[model samples]
Target: MFENLSERLEKSFKLLKGESKITELNIAETLKDIRRALLDADVNYKTAKTFTETVKQKAMGQNVLNAVKPGEMMVKLVHDELAVLMGGTSTDINLKGSPSIILIAGLQGSGKTTFTGKLANLLKTKRSKNPLLVAGDVYRPAAINQLQVLGEQIGTTVYTEEGCKDPVKLAKDGIAVAKKGAHDVVIIDTAGRLAIDEQMMEEISAVKKAVNPDEILFVVDSMTGQDAVNTAKEFNDRLDFDGVVLTKLDGDTRGGAALSIRSVVDKPIKFVGTGEKMEALDVFHPNRMADRILGMGDIVSLVERAQEQYDEEEARKLQKKIAKNQFNFDDFLKQIQQIKKMGNLKDLAAMIPGMGKMLKNIDFDDDAFKGIEAIIRSMTPAEREQPSIIDGSRKKRIAAGSGTTIQEVNRLIKQFDDTRKVMKMMTTGNKMGKMMGKMPIGKRR
Candidate 1:
């Protein structure tokens, strides 16, 4: 998302590459480059100026250790300053009160309704809270239907008053329904205008007054750039929102809204929408985001995603199968499915250290595994269990069933065989060493 900014910042740091320590004279050009990078990313000019100044001040004040290069020290200083610029720590939504109410506010087409559904899904699955989606967006035709569809997809309940034009009444009644039904959380999706208007603002303000919500979230489309930050300020001035939610962060955005909104509006970004899926919502962590923007990778977030898909019992079973060389196509397919559930493949890969830079120019499609999956699905149960059973005739049949070439099938079989061999060697620690020794002298450790 912040690809251009990351590259520019890297180049800026290179200005100090050969220097032994950070000095004011050498740091000026680097700061100018950093400020230019932020400005090019659509950041507010004043915010960018202040950010670079703060970073420069910090960099000049710190004593560089003998082990730390000047370039590395500058990168760390900028990373810390970036995090401070983007709300130093993550903020949690206030879910207090009986049947906690969360009011959603934003401009039209900001992905407000979509984020509402995602928040409900997160609450239901992660927090174990029974959340009721309140379709309070009375102006937009089919808005209730959209919320209902999202609720159905997420297995959550949607409360709607089909003909009700008064959002305040709808919000109040929605909370009442939630209380009666014992729903732990009520998320009210209010109406939004294409542009800020008096009528729209008043209606939402009246609803906020009526509901007295525990948390008010202002949803913003990060791709809107500085416009997003300006809109967030207007919303905060009117509704005094508790936090911000940046949507469509996975798009080709400059990331100005995420970096500048907090400084401008004095609000924390509670969550970020990474993809279109309901499961793509992530708690906004400024430090981790700073790391990602600097091409340092977000290993903590990567581990968290892994933990979300981890199952202790399943891991033990997989370990036993690997040890016995019984990890077949079925098991391999299951592993692929688990990885798919962890959000976008390219995004996941970017979470690894140094992988983001390697993948910067690569267009990684999430469906890259489609061919392998199709080939495996076309296999018979016996063939999947024992891949060795698939010979020349079976390969042709499987190729036809999967809409792939016989050569492609052969390639997949060879890849699977190689993977199994490597896995077997891993399981047998001594065997891995023996295999390495068999390689040419120069190639072997």
Candidate 2:
């Protein structure tokens, strides 16, 4: 995500290293570096200036504790300020209206249609709401087709008129359909242009007035930098959107749009598109984001993602199996599937404290687990249940079936055996059971 900005900010914080306490001269030097780092990250000039000044004011006002180092204190101040700069906290989308209607608006190529599908998937999977997607991009036939494909992929209903050119009418009709179908949420995906135009603005405004949507989200490509902020301002002036959606955020290293859009439009960022999958959307959390940006990791968000895939009954069964030293390849395969469902592998790893910097030069494929899954799947049910019985000849056969080498099979078996021993130990003293009890799983937010 904000790889470059993170690196820059870390270096700026190093200016206070070894300092016994804060001082005007030392703080000025650190603030200068911080300001330059923000500018290099494509942050708005005005926003950056205001942010540094506010951070400075707070830094100077702090009564540094004898136990806290100057570098540690400065980092804390900057981290809190960064969180405040990104809207201070997360904001939930309004869905109080019966068959709550949401309007999606943005410039073309901003991932509006994809975000629509992702939002529907989140509502359906996480919130337990029946959502209907409306293809309101009447100017583009391809958009309608795209929406249909996404709707099919996510198992949601999509409303569309074959040849209708009026988006306002499509949205109204779509809402009526939602009410008839007893859907709890209706998301209308509006059309976008290559650039801002009067017709685009007026058409979206008309739809907003007609539907009186409970929420209007402005999607923007985070990689567009300051241009994204400027475009958001223009849209807010016309539509007064309820929240902002930063798309392609996983691909944006500078993070200018995510940092500046809130300050420019004064709208909380509701969601961020982390990847291409329908499950890749995440509720925006400013404090967690600040943690990630400052190399502190976001353990809370990471645990929440794990909790989403955690099944209490399944975990209980798995615990019993492990207690009896019965954890097998089939069990291991299921665990991998649950982890894969959590989201991108690299993104999940980055949530661990200090892993972001360690993984800076490494490339993580989303399919990193494919080889292990294939190897496990190639095993016979007997072999999966009792891996210790596999001999040399069986290893050759399994390796050939899995398109892997015998050495790979040997490595996997060794790793599995080692893991089983550790799990057995955890279960021996009821340690694993106690940890599971402490986890806040199966709880509604």
Candidate 3:
């Protein structure tokens, strides 16, 4: 996501490479480079100009010490400015009021329906809200069905009225059903026009008036760049949307929309659609986004992903097995499965601090453990428990059973042995324990 814009921004920063002090001349050169980068990313020219000018003034005002290198100082200054441009802090979706209603609006094919599903999934799974997805797209049966499919996938209930031409009524009826069903959160996914039209705008406005929703979220396709911001402004003018949802961010978006939408629409970007997966919705974070655009990795998000997958009782059992030197390939495979549950491998890899920079050009797969998994699955129960007992003859048999080579089977045993050794040291040496023990701490304690 935004890889192209990230690349362009990185190129701009090279103007200060090997520079000593932040001279006005070199700074101006770098500023021009940054402006060009933003323009290339499809940022509006005026917004791009104002941004660089503000960045330039701030860069010059900073008290640069001899210890601070020009390049490093410029990076830091740009990061600060970028954060401001993207909204300085993450904003939460306002789920206030009993049966809080959040109305989703956007142009057709802007990923409005997909975002609605993702948002419902996020609220139900992460926020622990009993969310009912209200399908208001009466024009397309497929649209209502799409929301239902996603609702099923996320284990959330969807409310829809078939042949209900009046969406305002559909939404109202959906909420009434939700109330009876004991749902606390109601997300109304409204029908979208091919483009902004009088009929569609009025329809959405009517729904907004009828529901008086707690949050009116404008979802826009980030790949549309400046147009996304412009459309957001139009929607905000009509609905007075509470927040923005930048969708299709997982696509080849140039990063212009995320940077410019908030400033243009005067609304906080509350969430981002990082992928098509229901779990891909992320609460917008300005600082982390800045780091990502600058080719710096986001360790905060990486740790959050890890914490999301951490189960204390499970961890305790695994630790005991490790300490007793009984940690087998099955445990290793289960650990991998738990990590996979957190998120996409590519997305998780991007969150690792500095890993994105190192891996920008490489094609990394989430199934990096596939070969290991196949080999382990082919192993007999005894071999799984005692990998050391698998001799060369056993290796050839496992390889044939798993449809892998004998060398691959041998490599898996060696790697498994090495992993157990590391785990034993981590469990007994108190290194891993100290780290896990110092977590935010369980509230029950």
User: Model 2, 271-304: lDDT tens per residue?
Assistant: 9999998988999999999999999998998999
Q: Work out the TM-score per prediction.
A: 0.94, 0.94, 0.91
Candidate 1 per-residue lDDT over residues 288-316, each given as its tens digit: 99999999899999899888889999998
- Candidates ranked, most accurate by lDDT first: 2, 1, 3
Q: Which candidate leads the pack in lDDT?
A: 2
Give stretches of model 1 more than 4 Å off.
430-445
Which lDDT tens digits does candidate 3 get at residues 261-360? 8788779999988776677788999999999888788888878767877889998998888889989878988988877777767777887766776777
- Give the Å error, residue 227, model 2: 0.8
Per-model CA lDDT versus the true structure: 0.92, 0.92, 0.85
| lDDT, model 1, position 122 | 94
Give lDDT: candidate 2, residue 337.
86
The C-alpha RMSD in Å for every predicted model, in order, reads 3.1, 5.4, 5.6
